[model samples]
Target chain A: MAEVNRQILLVSRPQGAASTDNFKLVETPLAPLADGEVRVRNHYLSLDPYMRGRMNDTKSYAAPQPLNEVMIGGTAGEVVESKNAAFKAGDKVVGMFGWQEFGTSDGKGLQKVDDTHVPLSAYLGPVGMPGATGWYGLNRIIAPKAGETVVVSAASGAVGSVVGQLAKLAGARAVGIAGGAEKCRYVVETLGFDACVDYKAGNLYQDLKAATPTGVDGCFENVGGDGLDATLARMNAFGRIAVCGYIAGYDGVPVPLKHPSLILTQRLLVQGFIITEHLDVWPVALKELGTLVAQKKLHYRESIAHGLENAPEAFLGMLKGRNFGKQLVKLI
Target chain B: MAEVNRQILLVSRPQGAASTDNFKLVETPLAPLADGEVRVRNHYLSLDPYMRGRMNDTKSYAAPQPLNEVMIGGTAGEVVESKNAAFKAGDKVVGMFGWQEFGTSDGKGLQKVDDTHVPLSAYLGPVGMPGATGWYGLNRIIAPKAGETVVVSAASGAVGSVVGQLAKLAGARAVGIAGGAEKCRYVVETLGFDACVDYKAGNLYQDLKAATPTGVDGCFENVGGDGLDATLARMNAFGRIAVCGYIAGYDGVPVPLKHPSLILTQRLLVQGFIITEHLDVWPVALKELGTLVAQKKLHYRESIAHGLENAPEAFLGMLKGRNFGKQLVKLI
Candidate 1:
């Protein structure tokens, strides 16, 4: 293991859209861990929508990543050294290891990974934070019943792909919203959604109306904009909206809600939830999502960018909807 | 008693904002009630923001008022004559009596009222549907804890006024947003809110910041527009917003929400609820709210318009922010 580690830090806050200039690659010497501490060499770093919020220093449910600090992110890695009894050297693990090659932890939140059964990269994609987030939120918040229509945005992404499959697993008719025809096909054909609406299609309203003829009973919202308003217009009475993410407005440009009246008229329940808020459900969520993936009941795709050097470029591409699915950085 | 009854009906569905032409006042002969039916002489008719949704033909939780049909509304009145076992002559009652001087009911939802203690007008204001809506939503949905700051829009109106008071009763500092200084003062001093910001004061952002230094933890939203957007900006992490109404956007004219980005970043919970959805809690809610009003713990104001002919003017005035409090029409 190297004594010096490279990490990605925030160079500056983005005004409208995040760019490569917003990040800086820095090198620092690794320090020995104290009691109950473990050091892990990150193999796979997860890039997600929530990371965009941490880029800003404003107050949020989770503390914002401070300027010049290693940008906080999720990582799957193997323990290189340990002072904690719970973890051993060479054991695969998953934790908030930030955007770094090596991370030191006090073993407070590290979870052991079973790499023998699944690849280590799965921890950053299908069976990790993103997967469990979709599981817990869809199961608990929207709680789609049989015969109900479950609409999900970003349907081919890490979180939303799982949400579509989970809704189908629970016997609900899953309808997905994606940007391109290819992504829409993947969501409908591979993930087995009942229908897929291409939001990039200029006729979003017509597409949504045709897709959800019976109206949406549950909506897992990842993208919010004119599409959000359109979906809201087609929602059934007493519909539940799990506000998991707002990738549509991540551009920092204000998108006016075209149909603010839908909230009241439909008696919609729209709630913004962070998966970390329900950490207690992680064990069960991980086990279930893992089982589904292993059994081939769920399928996922990832756009892997090799090396830490391409992390910023990959992240920028992901934000621009250029990536096909879960965007990940591979560091070996 | 006159054999014929005069009534207001929906002439046409509003494409956007409702106009006086949308409502038609017509006289029709009264039909005698059956053995189970009771005749109610309207005393005070309630005009509320929810009525705006009813004017639209779109599918909503509450069915839209059909064109050429009597306009739906809530009313407090006297049971002038009754053939039902649940009601008697001269008993004051509250019900869905529509926009008319008199109506017949079968006592399915009729609640007999004794106005010997609180005035008859209180039934249409603080101790009635508006009061119950505010109290139930604030306590159950928003659930502001002690020391949390709760902000309410349309704070001098029926529902917002009660919401502010309920928040204050729960030991939270309540701030109100209203149209003018008079309403603001009434919300703060009369309703016991900590402070009230006048949106018409031309410094809404500055006033809101000064009023809620610690930030808004809960918001009882009765108005949706720029006010809702402003409140969204001031919301603290995990703030719960109970969407009681959208008075600001009811007029088919859209006040675009310029900042929906805050919904995701702040982890705000925005739930649009109807009090009637949970009618089982009404008895409990009324009992509690009654105690508050009787003990001088809650205060309410009424803007009563005399005669059923003036109901249209009263409703229009309320829509224009001219009504002082709960706008009501006195039939007798």
Candidate 2:
């Protein structure tokens, strides 16, 4: 292993939209493994939309990501050195290792996983935080009944892709709202959703209405602009909405719901959730996700950025919908 | 008791704001009571804000109020004549009798209420639909715990008065937002709310922020406008908002929530409900409401209009915040 650790830090807060200038990359000496500490060599750094919210100094589900710190993130890696009794060398693990090539933990929050069947990087997407996020939003919040219709925005992204597939698995009709025709095809053909609406087609409301013939009974909202507005218009009475993210409003603009009266008219139950606040569900979510991956029932794609230096651009691209699937930085 | 029934009919739909012109007075020949039917002489006609929503031909929780028919409403009256064994003459009951001097029911929806301890009109306010509405939204949706702050809009209105008192009874801090100083005084002094903010004071956000120092944990929203928007700004993390009505938007204006991001940032559960959809809670809700009114633990106020021909203006006044507490028309 190397003595030098390459890491990225949040240097400044974004004014409107995030850019690479807001982040800085530096090389520092890796900390030695102290007593009861384990050294992890991070392989993949997960770039999610929630990070954009943390970049602003606003009150949110989480505190603002402090400046001049290793950017907060999820990582999947192998234990290079261990001083804790619970962990051993060469153990594949996952934790909030942040945006760094090396991390030191006391094995407290680190979760050891079996990478024999599921790949190590897969834990950062399908069987990890994003996976658990999708699971909790769909299963715990929406709770789709059989034959019900579930519509998910950002349907090709990590969390939403899983929501659509899981909705189908629950015997509910799964419809997706994606940005492009290419992503829409992948959502329906690869992800096995019942139908897909390409929001970029400039016919969101009409297309969404046509896609959901019966009406949307449950919604997994990832983006909160026209896609969500259109979905709200087509919602059935007593529909449930799990607001996992508002990627459209992360640019520091106050995004308003156009039809606030619809909530009462439709009798909708709209709930917003942050996955980090619900750690109690990980064991249940991970077990099912891992089993599905091993059985080839769950599939996830990733857009890989090669170096730690490119993490800032990768993050900005993810926020602007330029990156497809789970955006990950390869720090190895 | 009478050969003809004097009634008000919805002759036209409102274009923007509901006016007296939409209603017409007509005396119709009463259909003689058939077998298994009961004739009710309506003593009190309950005028609520929800009637404004039904005046428009829009998709809502309940269907539109059909034109050229008696305006839909709740009524408390005496059973004048009965052909059903389940009901008898001189019995005090409550049901959806619409806006008229008399009503005939098949005894299916009629509720036999004991007005010995609770007054007949109190059944329309406290031990009735509005009472049950406050009960369900508070006990079922918000579910405020001890020491939590519960804020309600339209605080001096029928449903809001009960919610504030109920919040205090549940050991929570009750904060209210009313339109003027008089209603604000009644909310804190009569209804026993912890604090009442007069939205007309020109400092809604600042005043509400002062009233809820610890931040609002639960909100019972009746009118959607600046009051709700101000409450959203002061909401604590994991706050619960039970939306019962949007009187501000009933004028056919689209009301947009200024900060929809707050729902996600605060991790709130904002649900809109119609009490009619939840019949399961009526028994439990009415039991508590009835006992409270009977024991004089629950206090209510009403502004009664004299005749059924004036029901349209009474309704328009209630929608504009002219009437205090329950807006009931004395049809006796």
Candidate 3:
């Protein structure tokens, strides 16, 4: 076992866009586990867009990640040692273990994960929070009927990829909005989406309109700003928009929704959701996601940043749409 | 009976703000009623903000009102000449009779209104579409719990007044937003809202934050733009917003929602609804509204224009927030 634990802490609140300067790497002497505590050696630290909001000292769905503290995030790891009855050594588990090489928990929020049929990293992407988020937004909020056109922004990302795949599985036409041609191609050819609009290609509105000839019936919005506006413009009457994330505006600057009056005229249902608040659907979501992953039906991609020291740069890159898919840091 | 019917026709679509120039008053020969048709001498023509949208040559929840035709509107009238079995002479009925003194219908889409305890014009305000709209939004969309703060915009207007009253009846604290001090007073003192924030008072965000110390749990949004932004700023996590109308943007100009990231961080459910699409709730809504109006539990105010010739000006006035409460043109 390592004598020291390396952790990344938020040194300062981001004014607009977060950079590596906001984070600090610290190596602290490992302390012995207390009673009912399990020490986990984190294999992968998940870096998500929602983490950016946590860096701000403001009221949000979750409490702001404390300054000069370990930045909160999801981690998939193995139990290296345990003083808790719920967990045994070598047990694979996932929890909000944060940006660290080691995490000690009281076994309350930790969930045991099996990597027999699915890879361990799959729990951090397709069969985890991202998957459940997509499932809940697409199923509960959007609820697109068969033959409807469903548009998903950040199409190559963890959540959006699952959303498009699920929409296609439900017999709806899935149209994805991705940053580059390569990602767009993967979204269409690999993920089996009906169409993938490269937002970087310009003509966003016209491209979206061309993709959704029947008008958009549902939208899984990960990117807000222009992508959301384009989708709103093409939304059919009684359309639904499941706003999973607003990554475009997470950097302190406000993103305004253009032509909000269209919401009234179109009679749209736009719901914003946090997956953590909806744990009831997680069981159903994870089961389906696991089955898809096991059967090699669900496709997922990850851009890994080796070593815990690289996490800050990887997170910043992910925010800038630099990462291709799920951004993760390899700690072990 | 009058040989000629005086009607307001939409001569041209307004570029920005609707004015009297867009409407042309015309006298047309009354066509003879056919089988099952009933001729109604409209007593009151309801002038609503939605009429402004119908005047534009664009798609909306309902079809655009045809150019050079009787301007589309709801009317409460007496069936002076009924050729159908469902109605009789002097029978008070309500239907989409448009901006005219007399209307001929096949008795379809027309309902006989009782003025025993509730006034006939009450069917155009409290016991009508506006009332139902408020009820549907408050009960279904916002669904505020007891002790929760529910903020309502355009609080003295047709739909908003009813929404605040309903929220109070549901045991929720109702904070209202209105144009002027007088309207704000009516929203609180008359309509029984807990507090009223006058948007025209110029301290919208601060006033709203002060009024809703516990933070807004639900919002019945009638006026959008700045009013929406203010309410949104004070919203609690998991807040619900029932967007019934954006009267603030009814003049063809776009109303953008500021700080849309709040929707994601707060996990708000912002749904826009055209009351017409929710006819399933009308019977339930009307029954409750009728009982409330009959018992004087629900209070309402109406700004009445004298004749059908003045309908255009009244509508334009209503759009500009010149009239308080339900705007109606007394055609009789």
Candidate 4:
């Protein structure tokens, strides 16, 4: 058994953009588990854009991540040791284990997950928080009807990929906006989106217009820069926009929407939502998401960075649109 | 009846700010009414800010006011001669007679009303489209619960006055944003809004923040610029914003929403609506509004100019915040 545990701690808050200097890697002896506590060997650490928001002490739906604490994150792993009757050795679990090699929990938020059909890493992507985030935003907010056109920004990322697929499952026309040609191709070919716009191709407005010949009816907005501005311009009358993430504005400045007058002219409905605030939906969401994964119908890709020490780089890369899919770090 | 019918026509579209040069006052020979037509000598003309958007040849929910034609406007008058059996000669009626001294209608869209209790011009302001505008946005979109704070921009104007009054009736704390001290006073003292922030005071953000101690739960946005930007900063979680009008962006430019990231952090629902698009609700909305006005429960004010030739000036002044309430022109 591993006698020592390694963890990444946020040493300081970010001034503008976060860097590895803001975090410190530390080694600590694994404390003996208290009564009714279970120890987990975290296999994969989920690196998401939301973590960048947590790095700053700004007003947000979720509380700010404190300094000198293990960086907040989602993890999927196997139970290595247990002092609780509910958990046993080798049982797969999904929990907020954060950026660490091991976690000790009283089994409060820990959920026992099965990996008989779906892979263990997938619990961190599909059938997990990201999957549920996509489901709630698409289903509850956007509510795309059959034959309507739905556009998703950051289409290659964890949440957006699921949104496009589910939008397709709802029989709506799914379109995607990604940063590159390769990711855009993958989005259309593999995810079965009707069209994909490469935003980095230098003509986002024209490309998106060309891609969505019919104006966008529903939009899952993950990137909020020129992509959102262009989407606002092309939206049909009475369109719906689900504001999920704004990776472009996560640093010190809040990105301004360039054309807000479209909200009046087009009569659009723009709603912002936080997935964590809606905990009541998880049972139904996870049931559907978990079933799709078990049946091998849900398609997903991963960009895995080996070693816990490389998590910061992978997360920072995902913010820059460098990672192709779900960004994660493999600890084992 | 007058042999010559004088009318104001939109001769040319505005380049930037509209002026008297954009309209041409001409006297035309009154056309003879057809068998099914009714001729009405208009007494009042409603000059609204929406005319500015139509003058600029810009994108909007309504089509641009056509050039070289009688300018579009709502009017109230008594039917002077009736060829249609449904109308009598002295019956008071309301119709879109534009900026003209006389109108001939087939009675398709004309509505006869009883003015024994409510004034004739009240149909153009409170018991008319403007009143219904306030009703739909406040009731359907904002839907504020008791004790929730609702802020309305341009609170002294035609639509805004009604919005604040309706919100107060719904048991929400109504805060208004008006242009000057006098309008702010009227918004609070007469319209019964809980508070009014004078935007010309140069301390909008601070004053609004002080006024809404519990934060704003709903916003009825009429003028979109710094006022809207400030309101966005103060919105609470799950706030609802009904985007009714952006009078600030009416001429050749669209206003951008600064700090749009607040939409995500606050989890707001921002929807834009055109009152003209909602014809079905007018029946019920006007009934409630008319009863309130007739019973003197709803107070209203107006800025009236006395000639059709002066409508261009009145409209421009209303757009500049010179008018205190519903801007109108008395044709008689």
Candidate 5:
């Protein structure tokens, strides 16, 4: 068994943009597991935009991460030691294990994972929470018909990538909006989206308009700001917008929507949701995502950092769109 | 039958605000009715805010009013001459007969109205399009539960008056926002809304907050502007907003919504609709509205102009919130 456990703690809250200075890495001695407890050596720690909100002191869908505590996050790792009958040693599992090199649980919230057909790290990304978020927003909220145009922001990220691909599978035209040329290219060529608009191209409105000639019928918005404004301007009458995540405003001031009266004139429907509030759809979403990933029908990429101490930098980088696809820290 | 017919034509589209100068009144000779045609003497011409959008050359939910043609409007009148089997002289009917003292139709679009229990003018306001608009928005879009607070804008106007009353009937708390203290008093005292906030009182946000001690759970918006912004700020988590009309921005620049990211944090569902698109619900809505009005449970007020020549002035006044309740031109 490992004698030392390393963990990252949220020592301070961010006033505006989050910085690594708010976090502190600590080395602590691992104690013997109590009865029915299982100890896991985390292999991958997920770094997502939602973690930024958890760092704030304000109220949100979930409670704020307490000061001087292990930062909350999702993790996929192997069970090094188990006193619980439900989980055996050498078994792969996933749970909210925080930013740590090791985790001890009573086997309540943890779920066993299969790593034969898919890698264990994938349990933290696609075929997991992010994948299910895209599924819920696209199928339940947007529900675009065949031949309709669906626009997705953050098109190369974990959730947005899955959204575009799923929209294409539904026989809808998928148009992506990404930060740069390379990400946009990956969204179109690698992900098989119909078209991609480079939001950094300075002509966001014109570029988005040019891409969606038939006008956007549905939008899965992950990054809100000028991108959302541009998309709003191009929506067709009766368009649906699923507000999944507003990563653009997570760290700074929020971007206001201009011409909100367009919502009245165009008769649009805009809905916002948090996936955690809906646990009932997990079985269905997970089964389909697993089958797609195993069949090679769904593709994904990951930006991984080595060691637990670097998780804060990786998380900050993701907020700036510096990381590609799903951001994770390989703690093993 | 009258030898001369008085008609109003759309002379020009307004650049910003609509005015009487944009309309021209003329006297024309009434042509003899052809076979299957009916000549009707108009009793009331409905002056609604939607006419402002129709006057613009831009595309909207409905087609724009043709230049130099008779201005389009809904009218309730009695048939003076009929060569068609579907109607006879002295039968009261309602149809889109434009802004004219007299109209001749093939009796195809006309619906005979029975004014024995209800007034003929009620067909153009409470028991007609405006009433149905409120019903669809409240029942279908907002869908507030009993004890939930529902906020409505344009509280004393045609559509909003019905929305608050229906919400109260559904056992929900109805709060209204109107332009003046008189309208607010009418909404609370006469319409039986739980409370009404006067938007012109300079403390819109604070007043709205005080009126709704419990956060607003649903909103039926007709006049969008500062009123809508105030409502948005006070919405509860998972709140629903049904966008029916934006009379505030009909003739000028639209008001933008600030802190749109609140939609994400609150997980709100905002939907806009044109009532005409949902014709399948008309029978259900009309039956309920007619029953309520006949039972005296649905109370309404009208501001009537005495002549057809003053129709343009009435419509322009309605656009500026000058006329109270439902604005109409009564041509005897």
Candidate 6:
């Protein structure tokens, strides 16, 4: 059978809001797989805020997407051709690949996804990078003791939703902060959070005060702008804040810290993390999160776009807080 | 001979700059010692920036000083009279006493100051609370690896100066941020800092960049404001920041985080500390810091105001970055 290949290349670095002009879609014939390589036909692509940092030319934890290079993203795909003995054709796997319909990999950094246990999309959501991020931060950094108040921002989003639910499982009072009433209700009723604050409401500070009257002991900081300022104001002494992502400022804008004195006066701990940097810690977190999901103690939702061409729109929507949950683009 | 008892009280909270009006000079006859309390006379009053935080009514890790209460401070004094078995009349002791010419204290929180071994003023500087605060934060929180870049703000002040010297002893690249050329020179030559930036040199960002070209691996943050903004921009990946004090914003004024994205992008660890909260760790720190000071491994400078009446001015000067080194009130 003849092979087909589709590729998406980064055309330019985004100055502010990423536009379609930054990417170029192209079609080419698939090159034959070399020894020790596996060919994958992509099915689902993860759309995450971290990609914004990669779109810049500056040095970061991950290498910047070089000019005219393919935009990097985590992809779940089925092996269509294999020269590597580790993965045969038809094996489902997850790996870091550019925005493309098909990718050729050396099986390095690739994890075999057992599609028989969960839907393929779950590999990019609850049982994937975002969930592992929340788990590791909660366990290793915050170490939430039972009965403590735990606050998580971007509550309806992938990582934070998982974080709130996990805190609940650990017997902590889990509070969530989201952009709208619907997401707030979902976080409280669906994800088992004790309370949810609607940050988009004009009374964000008041709402937060009402939600966490005792002050939060631990915080999963996913959206870090005004919401971070509000959280900083209400944190208890010795509060631990896991600085996972600053989604609010990813567009290259500097957001001011409110009551910056909280960092000093309250004696709070704010630690930053990128899950990949702690990949060595992946097993313990993956095992726990997988068990939680398998036991139905955790839940996930996805707002998936149809194809690779729609990734830019999906990513832009995710940035604007328009996506309902883990934003993914279905490539196949 | 008639025994005299005098006290200093907080008359009014200062709005921007504290003045003599913020204090009330009062004279009261010494109250007869009650059970479980001892009567002692104030000798040397320890003036520090942390006292400014207590003067405010806002909530903090430590309780705020109530209006019209005695101005709180740490002091090294001779126990002229002791009702408790732990002290004697001629014994040199240290306690958390407010700014006063003569005051009484219970034996609690008082440590005998071996004045014969070290100068009495050392109880408030290198071998006392200030030194212990710097030592614990630097050694425990930052834990600079040998040859790592360690940057400290208020580099010639009580805490930061000690932190820099300790970092040097730990074999790290120690850089300091101070307000003047003289202080910066002292930080480099006297305190053994690899480099020192003058925050008052008109171009702080450029100066800081020049001083820490490798980027800061650890930051001992004391004077947080514009200097903090500059420091945040220069942190390397996984940098640790010990927030000892925000002397720059201790007065009721808001200071914003300049670029919060640094926390996320660099995976910085920022933690606040109160020296008293970790009193359990104080002895260990004191032992180490005392050795450093005694052995000339650490050097300290003091700006001693001659009388108790000059404390308000000295404190005001400290807040304005005018006082050199550790500001103290010397009493006969």
Best by DockQ: 2
The lDDT of model 6 is 0.85
Clashes of 5: 0
- Please give me the DockQ of candidate 2 compared with the native complex: 0.89
Clashes per candidate (backbone, < 3 Å): 3, 0, 0, 0, 0, 0
Candidate 6 on B48-97: residue-level lDDT in tens?
88888888777887777777777888888888777788888888888888
Residue B196 displacement in candidate 2 (angstroms)? 1.0
Better of 2 and 4 by lDDT: 2
lDDT of 4 by residue, A1-332 (tens): 78899999999998888888999999999989999999999999999888998998888898899999999999999899999999999999999989999999999899898888888888889788889999999999889999999999999889999999999999999999998899999999999999999988899999999988988999999989899999988899999999999888999776788889889889999999888888989789988988988887778999999999999888888889899889989998
Q: Please give, for residues B1-332, the per-residue lDDT of candidate 2 as tens digits.
A: 68999999999999999899999999999888999999999999999999999999998888899999999999999999999999999999899989999999999899998878889999899889999999999999999999999999999999999999999999999999998999999999999999999998999999999999999999999999899999999999999999999998998889888888788889999999999989999999999999998898999999999988888888888988999999999987
Question: lDDT of candidate 3 vs native?
Answer: 0.91
Reference contact recovery of candidate 5: 0.84
Candidate 1 lDDT score relative to the true structure: 0.86
Which portions of model 5 miss their true places by more than 4 Å?
Answer: none
Tell me which of candidates 1 and 3 scores higher on lDDT. Answer: 3
lDDT of 5 by residue, B1-332 (tens): 68999999999999989888999999999999999999999999998878888898875778899988999989999999999999999999999998999999998879899998889999999899899999999999999899999999988999999999999999999999988989999999999999999988899999999999998999999888888888988989999999988876777676778778778888999999988899999889988999999999999999999998888888877877787899999999
Worst 10 residues of 5 chain B by lDDT: B247-256
How much is B241 displaced in model 4, in angstroms? 0.6
- Cα-based lDDT at residue A324, candidate 3: 94
Alpha carbon lDDT of residue A155, candidate 6?
91
Better of 2 and 3 by TM-score: 2
Q: Write the per-residue lDDT of candidate 4 for residues B84-197, one digit (tens) a residue.
A: 999989999999989999999999899999999999999999999889999999999999999999999999999999999988988999999999999999999999999999
DockQ of 3: 0.84
The CAPRI category of model 5 is medium
Q: Which stretches of candidate 2 lie over 4 Å from their true place?
A: none
Candidate 4 differs from the real structure by a C-alpha RMSD in angstroms, to one decimal, of 1.4
- Candidate 6, residue A51: the lDDT equals 86
The candidate with the higher TM-score, 1 or 2, is: 2
Say which docking band candidate 3 falls in.
Answer: high
Ten-residue stretch with the least lDDT total in model 5 chain A:
A248-257
